[model samples]
Target: MSVASEILTALRSEEHDPVRLLRSASNLLGDEIAVMSSFGAESALLLAFVAEAAPDMRVLFLETGKHFPETLAYRSELARFLGLTNVQDIKPYLAQVKDRDPTGELWAFDPDACCQLRKVEPLDAATLSFPVLVTGRKRGQASTRAALPVVEEKPDGQVRLNPLASWSADEITDEMKRRGLPPHPLVSKGYPSIGCAPCTRPVGENQDARSGRWAGLSKTECGIHTAS
Candidate 1:
């Protein structure tokens, strides 16, 4: 079996344990693995696991120029709190940004294109050398992800690991509470899902956690996760 398949097989038994999965992946992939984070709601849970298992693991955060000031601040605060030493902010190319979105209002007319420019391109470029990618996506977050797998192999042979794929919202909340993890400040304000400022909003108590993201539009993801 290939290394990816072996990794998957080994992780099957401990799929529910994020820290164990992270440690195993770190051991297997070493410098070829990196974690992609948004530093949004519930992000602390995954970062905590990274801190415990691989404190120096490369953590890539898409620093879209449109993120809320609160999110930028929270990213710094959470990194400090978890003692994550390798968190890097991935930003889009300045030439592309100026050529495509000079006014910074592309999100108003075409959010998908904006996301492609700011998130997808930057992440694709940043992760080109990494063979394994880790994310905190969960099945319970949205209907589109209801069947998310713990391990997925992209067409290009890159392995995407979702250690928290099977975790429920309650499980996440309980674990975070038990660990005293600090939440994204916007979560208490009803923004259970936080993204770029212009395309995100607060949802009702009964709404899906991700419903506030790209509200009124069909776009659910920021293209970084969906592309490739």
Candidate 2:
């Protein structure tokens, strides 16, 4: 079957749960797996799961350089705990940043341009070699992603599989606790949703986990999630 046919068929398959679906996809792709991780609040669960299923999977981290220090540190700690060997750090294009905006205040001025520079461009370089990428997105987390499928396609000629698409906040917490996984430092400090330092804020008492990200703004994703 063609790649498109295989993806469509897999999307309709009910035999594969989240875990089994990811494992099957890895096997189908000949073991070239790219696990894009943000090392955020609930990312630990995905890291742990992938560590167990595919320990050597290429864990891609888009190091936007503007990320919180805590996030970077937690990322390292989590990788060590999970025994992940291939943690690839995808960075921005130096020449573009230097030529376009040398002061690096692009994020403060134009967020869209900043995202294109850091998140979009980096992932474009990172996942080019992989046929499939596993994301830790959950449907219940956001309104836009409420209908996310277990498996979907990206416009970049590859598949974007949301293994935990059906998961909820409670489920994620339970799994993390059950596995004895430590939450990110900012997670318990009112910042249920942690992003880059400048943009991220503490969530309100009744706000969702992702409310802290791009707080007070209509933007939900950092362009990386919406990449086609």
Candidate 3:
């Protein structure tokens, strides 16, 4: 079996406990595991676990220039609230952004390419040294992630860990409440899945949490998660 498969098998019993899963992964990978966080709605839950289990673990945030001001504020507030010491803001290369999206309107004409330049490439560069990448993705957020597993090896041989893969929306809310964690400021404004301001919108009551992201387009993911 691959190392990721072996670790997944060993961690099966703790899959339901995100804190335990994170702690175990930290123990197993030492300094090779890092987390990717969007600091959007429900991000605090995973970040809280990170604070408790691995306070100093590198928490990478894709600081795309187009994010809502509220999201930027909340990112600072939550990191302070959670006592996270290593939250790194990963920004896209300025030269590439200038060359590919000179007008900064790429999100209007080609969101996929926008995300590739702003999020995917930056994240890929930020995580190059980490063999194990942890994320806050959950199955309840979108149909595309419905079958997400707790651990899987990517095509590049990197182990991607979705510690909260099976958590429901209610479970996330309850746990965050139980821990007294604050919600992202945009959540009250109807953004269940917040992203860059230009591409995100407010979804209706019955819509998927992630339906707000890239609203009219068929694009569900922002390329970072889908890319190897």
Among residues 3 or more apart in sequence or in different chains, the pairs in candidate 1 whose N, CA or C atoms overlap within 3 Å are: none
Each candidate structure's TM-score, on Cα atoms with residue i matched to residue i, is 0.96, 0.91, 0.95
Q: Which stretches of candidate 2 lie over 4 Å from their true place?
A: 1-4, 7-16, 155-157
User: lDDT: which is higher, 2 or 3?
Assistant: 3
- Against the true structure, candidate 1 reaches a TM-score of 0.96
Model 3 ranges off by over 4 Å: 1-8
Estimate every model's Cα lDDT from 0 to 1.
0.90, 0.79, 0.89
lDDT of 2 at 200: 85
Model 3's C-alpha root-mean-square deviation from the true structure amounts to 1.7
Instruction: State residue 102's C-alpha deviation in candidate 2, in Å.
Output: 1.9
* lDDT by residue for model 3 (104-150), tens: 99999988899999998998888888888999999888888889998
**Ranking by lDDT, best first?**
1, 3, 2
